[model samples]
Structures are given as C-alpha cells and as structure tokens.
Target: MSSLISTPIAPTSHTLLKPNRNTLLRGDSLLPKRLSCTRTRSSSTTRALLSTTKESVLKDFHERRALKIISGLQNLNKENVASVVTAADKGGATHVDIACDPDLVKLATSLTSLPVCVSSVDPAAFSAAVEAGALMVEIGNYDSFYEMGIVFSPEQILNLTKETKRILPSMTLSVTVPHTLSLPDQIKLAEQLEQEGVDIIQTEGGKGSSPSKPGVLGLIEKATPTLAAAYAISRAVKIPVMCSSGLSAVTAPMAITAGASGVGVGSAVNKLNDGVAMIAEVRSIADSLSLSTGRHIVSEKNTLRL
Candidate 1:
C-alpha cells in the first residue's frame, strides 16, 4: 500500500488582504479581531462540519514527530534519487521533496511508499509533478530563481498557490511563504495561503548568493526568518506550518518549540556522501525533536493514516 493518501478538496481561491503598508489602524489592529469575529460568526453548522473534517485531518504531523526530509538541491540528479529514498526510509522521514521532474517522481514513487513532494516555480511543472505521482507539491522553492534576479513576491506566491489549486484541488498542497519578505510580510502571506486552503505553510531563509551553512550557528541564522514566520503563522492559521531551507538537527527542536508543526530539512541530510550517514543524521534530528517537544515519535505501526 502507498503511504500517500488523498484528502477532500479544500476551499477555492479566497484572498483577504491585511491592512496594507502605511494604512492607519484607526484603532487596535483589526485583522486579528476581524478574523476572530469571522470564526466566531461562522454558523454552528458550518463550524461543526469543519470540526468534523479537522478531527479527521492530521494537523499534528510534528506533534506525532514526523520529520519530513527534503533531499538536497544537488540530489535532484537522476543518479541520486535511489539514495534519497534509501536515506528517507532508513531515517524515518515521512516524505521526500524533489524537483518537479517526471523521471524523478516516477523513480521516487517506485522506490518507496512514502509521499513524494515536488518543488518548482512554474505552474506547469507543479501540475506535472502532481500527475507524475507526487503526493504533494510546493512552489517558491526557487533558490535558483533568486540567483537569476527573480524574487518571489507575496503576490507571485499567492498567485502560484491559486493556480496550482485550480489545477489539482484534491492533492495535498504546501505553499512556501517566501523568506525574502520582512517578518510582517511573511506573516501576512502565510495567513493568505491558509485562507486559500493551503494544506501546509513552509518558510525558508536567505536565498541567492547566500552561503549555505550547517550545524548550530548556521541553523540558527537560517532558521530565524522561518522560525519567526512559523511562530506567527501557526497561531494565525489552522493548518500546519513547516520550517525549511537552512535547518539542522540542533535547530529542529528549536523549530518545533517555535510553533512549527514539522520541518523540511534539505541540505543537512542530502549533502552527505554516504546514505547511511545521511539517514543517521536525519534520525538524530528526529530524535532531538522528539525529546525537546516531549512528543513520542510515532512508530511505523502508530503512524496514523490521513
């Protein structure tokens, strides 16, 4: 049986703009007040329907200690795909994230039952990834885009999510809240993604010409933006928020403490020469996260199906 499972369709495109930059608050800020009012005013019947579905939906992937491993950008090479799956399986990674390439998805799905998440900037590429057996999809995993003078603005990222949702409404969707934004902008985009029915919200750090650092200091620096975003978004949205990009074992638990439901570590594991070492690293990170959060890492038997 496959690890990937499909859930019911989420809401269609619904955009709510926060008070724009330079807009006067007039009184105590109204965004949160208004959102709370909306939730409060939602008919009891509607709330009950949502509660029923949310109860069935697993939002605590992190509380369950599911550490998702995103194979390194370098691992997108066709030759490294098998090793990526091997590492993910041995390390107890819930899924692997790959580039939106058909061959990679086919190879990854064939190699493991774990869900495969494909990343790309193009709508066509994301659509292809979903069709090619990717159980989930991500946009704005565009380190390369930043290098080429392309920045993923809030408008662009939200538009991508809207377009992707229109194409694959039933697929699990995780939208990256661009790290390029200031802390406030990141929070707003995250909430927007949540309103647009994003199943997951991911945040990253600096991009393009940015030196990739690993271990403690690097993890802390890289995690700063995503961690802030996670802290803000987790409370703002009902969906899960994941911290990604420059994360490591040391900071994995920190991320959880900062309100992340889970984490997506890319270069930390996939950059290793030996798959076993990579797996071991992932396991250590997962173990650290489990200990810090006081949550038991779900055994394979205990891993609840969505």
Candidate 2:
C-alpha cells in the first residue's frame, strides 16, 4: 500500500528543456527576416563584384589586340584533350570549346583557368559536360555533320532548343544556325532561337563556305549570313549573338558593326600547332577589333569630351 502511491513529476522550464544534439547545433543566429535581409545584401555585393569583373574583362579583351580563340578539340581521349587545351591557353585563347565528353571536361577544367565550353548533339550529354565543369555550351559545330549526310535544318535547330531547355533549364545556352539556310531563313531561325531563351545565337557560313575565302564566301563575303543573323537575333532577343566559323581579324570589325556581341573563330587558331604563333594571330585580330571599337568610342566621346 505504501509503495502504490504515484508521485507527479514537475514540468520542466522551457529553458531547461534542452534541445537535442542535432537541434542544438542547427539554430540560426538571426531572425528569419533579418537573415533574409543579410542574405540579400550579400547577394547584391557578390553580383556587383561579378558584374564589375565581367565588364573589365570584356573591356580589356576588346581594347587589347587579342582575339578570343575558340579552339575546337574533338578528341575524346583525356591526354589529347589536355594537350589541345594547353596549347590554346598558351596561345592566348579566351575560352576553349570541347566536345561533350566527361573526361575531356575534367581535363579541360584541370589544365586551364580559361572558360570551358562544351558542345554536344545530345542535351543529356551537354548537361553532364556542364556538370563536369563547362562554363558554356555550344549546340552546333556543323563541320562534323558535313560528311555524315546529317543536316541541321531549321526545324532540327529549333527542336534542339526545346530539348535543351527541358534538360538544362538554367544552362547558358548557345545555339548555332547552319549557314546553309537562305538569309531569310537564317533571320527567321535567329529570331526563333532568341525567343526560345538561348543565351547566344551563332551563325555559320554553311557548306564548304569560308566566310573569307575568295569566292565561296556567299554569306561570309557580303557579311550577309553572320551579320544578318546577328542583326536579326540581337534585335529580336535580349541575349548576345556571336558570328562564328568563317570570321577573321580583317572581317571581325564588320561582324561587330553588324551587331555581333562577339565573334568565334576556329580554323584561324586550330590549324596552327604553335602556341606563340596562335597567340600572335589572336592578338592581331584583337588589335584590329579594338582599334575599330576605339574609333566608334572616340566619335561618341568627342561630343562629351569637349
């Protein structure tokens, strides 16, 4: 009978109700609203830094006599990939474009501090390549298909946007339109690509066409294809447009004047095996573009400078 009486336990104070080991270490030091405000300020600071860096880099790249060599290295082997990227870097390339292969991406990332771009026919492969460390991605290098009997029609190009968006919604997408299309079609495709959320729309010279070659330069000759696509796409979309494939230092200014935000050249750098020679070529192109850009800037500043 004496042992049957039950004693009631006193309620512990809230302060004494200690949190679990996990909970104890997981509390935020600031209130939710304050935390959010602090995060916003930090984000703004970071963004400002990044923007300033990008502007300075672009300015220097434009102001100096250097062409951003977009060297195309299709080899899947890691060692070959490293060698090509290393050569491009020593040659003064702004960025390197590699085929969609995971090993190549790792090699590129490890070998150089330059921006890495991944090109792929498969959206999933592009995603993997980006995850592997690619800062950019190019959808077309039409030269690969020239002999494969595979053509990158307007429809096919548009479908690529749909697929890429579905797979990698936030990726910085760059879609290239085959130069084979007529000017009208090229413009139309450029407009469509812009509307589809592509970050950059590149135009090529199409079918054995070198934009600067003696007579084969249909669009490349009159500065029609790349210029047309850039003008159309730049006007249609807020994203940047790059004129690539057949561009050179001599014609780079025209490409920029026609509305290209940047130009991408492959053969001008890739065909050369010497890094120093490559850098010199890029530097010459960069110099030409900078001088031209400087003239435009001076004209605009003349009114203000006075």
Please give, for residues 25-89, the per-residue lDDT of candidate 1 as tens digits: 33335547875566566646665754554333334463545567776433467766677677876
Clash number by candidate, in order: 0, 4
- Assess candidate 2 and give its TM-score to the true structure: 0.67
Looking at candidate 2, the ten consecutive residues that score lowest on lDDT are: 1-10
Candidate 2 lDDT, 1-306, residue by residue in tens = 111112122222222133446643354543376776686788699677656644443442343222345545354656445655775566445567778887788888888887777887666566667668776677887666655556667776777677777666555677888777776788788888878877677777633454455643543474555666666666665656777776776677777777777777777766666656666776666566774355458788997888
TM-score of each: 0.72, 0.67
Which regions of candidate 1 deviate over 4 angstroms?
1-64, 72-75, 206-215, 291-306
Instruction: RMSD for all candidates, in order, please.
Output: 13.0, 16.3
Q: Give the winner by lDDT.
A: 1
Q: Which run of 10 residues does model 1 get worst, by summed lDDT?
A: 1-10
